[model samples]
Target: MTLSVLVTRATFADIAQRLHDHFDVDDNPDDALWDPDELKRRLQGKQGVMSHGSDRIDAALLDACPTLKAVCNVGVGYNNVDVEACTARGVLVTNTPDVLTETTADFGFALMMATARRIGESERFVRQGDWTKTGIFDMFAGSDVHGATLGILGMGRIGRAIARRGSLGFGMRVIYHNRSRLTAEAEAESGARYVDKSTLLREADHLVLVLPYSASSHHAIGAEELKRMKPTATLTNIARGGIVDDAALASALRAGTIAAAGLDVFEGEPRVHPALLGLSNVVLTPHIGSASIQTRRAMASLTVDNLIAALGAGPQAGQPPTPVNPEVLAARLR
Candidate 1:
């Protein structure tokens, strides 16, 4: 009997075809966003699921679907899935990691430059017909990216990629703070200096957050942290939402605590804070960090690969390419 699979969101036509070749596939061509109850209902007979960040795959949902054996995520971050809960029930979880590194880094750097140079606000000004001859000299003068201090909150793969752009391409001073320090060789490779969180906040002319989201990391940049930043500094978040307190960030931008901000992700997502929407100094974009066509295709293909492997349907049967909980697979083999 063929295994039943569900693609949780709309995906590339080719990707769906690949899954269809191997399994009894149920895909959302219309891309309707299903709430928890609806999601569980759709997941009833599914043995595998391709989950996105918006889907909440918890113990409750896991319990409801006893047939589920694999959860493949399209993005690098897996904070949305309850890995511990999935582990307890012997469900394998996997995410696409390396394929999106450079593309996401590219977007993060672009967002930072746009924020520092007031590109978003200036574009708005031009669109609104507010560009006049009288204010030519100082109308939209903004900060410089080259030779400025670039501070990163997380020095992971994406963070290191951003550091390379800042230090090598732009001649910026790169400093980073992570939960643990990188080795000396890694520091030299990335051109980043190790710094404490306080120094990172105080020194950075452009502070970019690339940290993961979790309970401890919830609102990592709140009111007090914002207070520590230089008034002329610009803040950028290419990381997940809820990493920065959107409310505190809006207040900071309003009071000139920081000169500007560029956010690709938000707290509630798809539904941004009203205060952030009204601000001229903040540049906002939908979460499209790894949005390049090639990269997105790679991510979707990898998800299908993991799902095919986990369900013993394809070339890598019993050996999924990337397993978040490999121990579960290990135990099964034993």
Candidate 2:
């Protein structure tokens, strides 16, 4: 019997075709945003789903969709899916990782550069016909990125990539604080020094947040933490939403608590804080950290690979490449 699958959002035509070849595929061609009930409705009778980061899968959805045996997330982050719930329900969970790491690191650095140099604000100024004077000494003067202290909050793959860029390419001082310090060899490779969280906050001229989001990380940078930062320091967050307190960030920007900020994700995304929208000091981009065409295709292809493998079809019949719950695969063997 052919397994059934659902593609939660529109993807590259070829990705859909690959899934179609292996399973009974149901895809959302219109790219419509479905609510929980609508998603559950569409998920009915599907054995696997190619899910987007925006799609939330929890115990409720798992309980509702009994046939679901695999969930292949299109992004590296799997916080959108409830892995514990899926594991308990015997559903295999997988995410596309490594393929987009370098791409995301590239974007994160771009955002930081744009923020520090006031690229976004200057572009808006030029478009608004405010470029009357040339070479004014302090006109739109911004912070320098090269040779500045680059503070990374989470030294994961992307964080380490950012560190290498800052240290090797830009000659910046790389300081990081993670759950655990990287090994001596890893530290030498990245040229990063591990520091306490408070020191990381206080000393960094440009702080980039690449930490994952969870209850402990929620509002990790709030008003009190904002106060601790140097008045000239810039904060960049390419990490998940809710990692920084958005309202507090806006207030800090208004009060000049920090030099500026660049944010790719937000507390309640798709609906940015109104205050941030009005501020010229803040550079905001819709969550597009891993949005390069080549990277996105790779992510989609990996998602398809996981779904095809988990459903007992495809090249790697019984083994998904990046399983969040390998125990599910083991259980299948038993």
Worst 10 residues of 2 by lDDT: 14-23
Q: How accurate is candidate 1 locally (lDDT)?
A: 0.95
Model 2 per-residue lDDT tens digits across residues 227-280: 999999999999999999999999999999998999999986888999999999
Clashes of each: 0, 0
Computed on alpha carbons, the lDDT of every model, listed in order, comes to 0.95, 0.94
User: For candidate 1, lDDT tens digit of each residue in 50-103?
Assistant: 999999999999999999999999899999899999999999999999899999
Model 1 residue 317 lDDT?
A: 92
Q: What is the lDDT of residue 121 in candidate 2?
A: 95
RMSD of each: 0.9, 0.7
**Which stretches of candidate 1 lie above 4 Å from their native place?**
none
Backbone clash pairs for candidate 2 read: none
